[model samples]
Target chain A: MITFDDVVKVYPGGSTAVDHLSLELPTGKTTVFVGPSGCGKTTSLRMINRMINPTSGRILIDGQDVAGQDDALLRRKIGYVIQHAGLFPHRTVLDNVATVPMLLGKSRKEARTAALGLLERVGLSAEFASRYPAQLSGGQQQRVGVARALAADPPVMLMDEPFSAVDPVVREGLHREFLRLQKDLGKTIAMVTHDIDEAIKLGDVVVILRQGGKLAQIGTPQELLDHPADEFVAEFVGRDRGLRSLSFDTAAGLPVRPLTADLLLDEAGRPVSWGDGEPTGGTFTVEDSLRLVTDLAITSPVGIAVRVDANGKADGLVPHHDLVDHLAERRAAK
Target chain B: MNLSYLFDAAHWSLTADGSIPQLILSHVWYVVLALIIGTIIALPVGLYIGHTGRGSFLAINAGNAGRSLPTLGLLMLMVTLLGLGLTPVLIALTVLVIPPILTSAYAGMRTLDHRVVDAARGMGMRPWQVLFKVELPMALPVMMSGFRSAALQVVATATVAAAVGLNGLGRLLIDGLAVNDYSRVLAGAIVVAVLAVVLDLILALAQRWIVSPGLR
Candidate 1:
């Protein structure tokens, strides 16, 4: 866990970057700091490792003050990933990932061995190990950056818009991989980004900051979406936040009706088409999100979503009106 | 132009003091010594300035000043003050070598992607480690180009040593001119030009070997 104890950062010329901000990033979870430009999200992230020291107040990592620790030693213990990956252009990918371990006194052979496994874990092949950062594309380089950060197995990770530099398609892939890696490692991660949709997708706890580095609100993604603190946050989360919140809930408990005769099925019991051999829009399983189920239902020509089982066999149906009723019931229960 | 002097076996003799072989050796000796002295004096200063961004004014202006100062005039002035010997010629040649090396080192450090340095620091590398492990290796291409130019300049200019009673390939030119033997003078000029090109080629090969292929 990291705690900011009334931290303030005023630049030498008297411009305030962070204004007496106090917050706690919980252990073993991802906390996202998000806001517009000049909100000090990046500044606050840098202060954790003393890259930019706070003007006043202390930042503590697991109850120990970062100010008292040596800069290099403290930084070594905290993994950091930035927008462009910031790789050493001269070093091969293997050596780049091996940097932290080698700096911490591991032998070159040992470090390289560990680095090979890390590259694989990050979805890079052994062929890429000998290649330099320039030989790889933007998305590939970012993976190497992540691999390098994890080389020392640091308990805390700081990310500053790590996925922002890539194209949208590559960013989506990276986001999925990142979540999977985080699920397994569970490092105490603090990331900063300006995109609220990203904050909603990745953050366990979202910290919204105002223009002057002041905290606007701090809560879970659903909490922030459902109950914004003010007009700024409401506008920031966007107008369709209610629809977006459906992503968090699954369609498991929603009632489904028996499949009708018009729904055609293959020999293996999979839904192949609707009435008159017209193809089915799509199929959703019980594990799928409410959002996916709602989308399927609304888009289906016959106004019903096919519910499939784990084996892809059509089992039940969810009509559009039933989804509305289910949503209304959920609101009443809330 | 009498070409007969260059073809004479007596002038090519290894044992003779003023023969082509002996003159080439002396010429190489002057170029090597001047380069060694100049690098020893300039490389560290250049690296320091580049690494710290201090003394930038000195780095920027030193190259122009060093280039503009006439080597012949400096050698004559040194000879007048210190008496005629190898010292004055060496001092002049070493002066000619410093500017390129120092300026190149500074430019190399300045042009580095700052983000790479930031990543290095953030990865827990000590200041010296960052210099040796990251900055120095990356800056080699620029530093080497500077060193090559310095060597080329020193090779071409070391001929001035013959003006101060020093034995080198320059002797062929100075002695030839004194006796009106155009063949010997032409031979000296050709040898010096060839030596410069050969030295530059060797340095280019060295740079290719040392610098990371990734940069290319």
Candidate 2:
């Protein structure tokens, strides 16, 4: 777990980038800090590893104060990736990814082996390892950047708008990949983004910071969407946040039920198929949260959406009423 | 100095005990020797000033002063202080070449992306590792160009050493001027210009060869 206790950052010129802010991040989940540009979201992320020192207050990583640790040693234990991928242009992709491992005293052969494996994990082929950063496309470069950050397998990763540089399509693809990786890897992550859509899509915990780096609100996507705490968060989340609340709920409550139930049973007594097409995304299995069901419905305007089986077969359906109430109940609870 | 008159100049030197080969060899050796020594001595100075981003306090003032010094003027004065011969010529040429190299190296290092530096640092690079592995690699292309300019200038300035009694292509012009041999003057000027061109081309090739292939 990473905790920031009354942390603040004041630039040399006396401008406050982060006010006296405090936050806690649990292990094995993603916490996203998001705000407009210069709102100190990035500054907050940088402080976990002491990339930017807090002017006051203590920052603890797993309850250890960073001020008392050797900075390089501290940073070596926390992964970081930046907006442009920050791959060293002169080094080959493999060498770039192997940086921290090599620093941690791994043999070159061992580090290279680990790096190649990570490259594949992040979706780059081993053949691309010898190539330089300039040779990679923007999206591929960012993947290499992620691979490099994970090279040390640090328990926590701090990223500053890692996907913002890519085109919208690539950004979406990366977001999907990141979610998949997070599910599989379970590393605690703190990511900063300016795009509210991204915040809602990926944030297990969303921190909305006000203009001067002060915290406006912090909650799960459902909680923030349902009760914004004030006009600033409500406006920042935009007019459509009511709809945004539903998806988070779907992931939790509405797992696909037995098709034999009163909801939308078909000839085989299954949720009716739109062929093999899924209605609520494939996430609504007996395993998935109702929040997943809600997101699938939002993806399509039709009143009913199907949930898919592991083989992509339609297993069950979720209706608009069920999705809508999930969000409403969450808001009322807040 | 007439082009038509230089044929007579070569004949004139060739007939004077065939001294042309010996003279050219000696001149080449002196200029190349100074260039190598000057580069070695100046590299650390240049890299330090450039890498630290504090060159303005010293590099700008010193380099401007160095650039403005009349090299021949300095050679004549050094002839008295260091006492004429290769010593004065080497001093003058080395002084002439260092400033361009130092200032350019400083500027190149200073202008590099700070994010790149931070990334290297954040990756657990030692300060030395960052310098050798990252900062130096990026700064090399520009620094080499500076060295190129310095070398070309050194070649041009080396010809002026005849004032200090060093036997170089300038010997031809100075002797020709002393004896009113216009043919000799024309030959010396042609040789110096060609030598400068050749050295400049070599420096260009060195740059092409030394810069990383990606940057090239």
lDDT of each: 0.93, 0.80
- lDDT of each residue in A1-334, candidate 1, tens digit only: 9999999999998888899999999999999999999999999999998889999999999999999999999999999899899999899999999999999999999999999999999999999999988899999999999999999999999998999999999999999999999999999999999999999999999999999899999999999987899999999999999889889889989999998999988899999899787667999998889999989988898889999999999999999999999999987877
**Real interface contacts reproduced by model 1, as a fraction:** 0.68
lDDT of 2 by residue, B1-216 (tens): 576645645544643542555556667777788767777877777778777765567877767988899998888888889786788888888888878877777777887778778777776677898888888888888888888788778766777877767777778788889999887788778877788788888878877776665555
Residue A7, model 1, lDDT: 98
Error of 2 at B169 (Å): 2.8
TM-score of chain B of each: 0.97, 0.87
Where does the lowest 10-residue lDDT sum fall in candidate 2 chain B? B14-23
Winning model by DockQ: 1
> How well is each residue in B160-207 modelled by candidate 1, as lDDT tens digits?
999999988889899999999899998888878888898899989998
| Candidate 2: stretches off by over 4 Å | A251-334, B1-25, B32-42, B55-65, B179-191
Model 1, global lDDT: 0.93
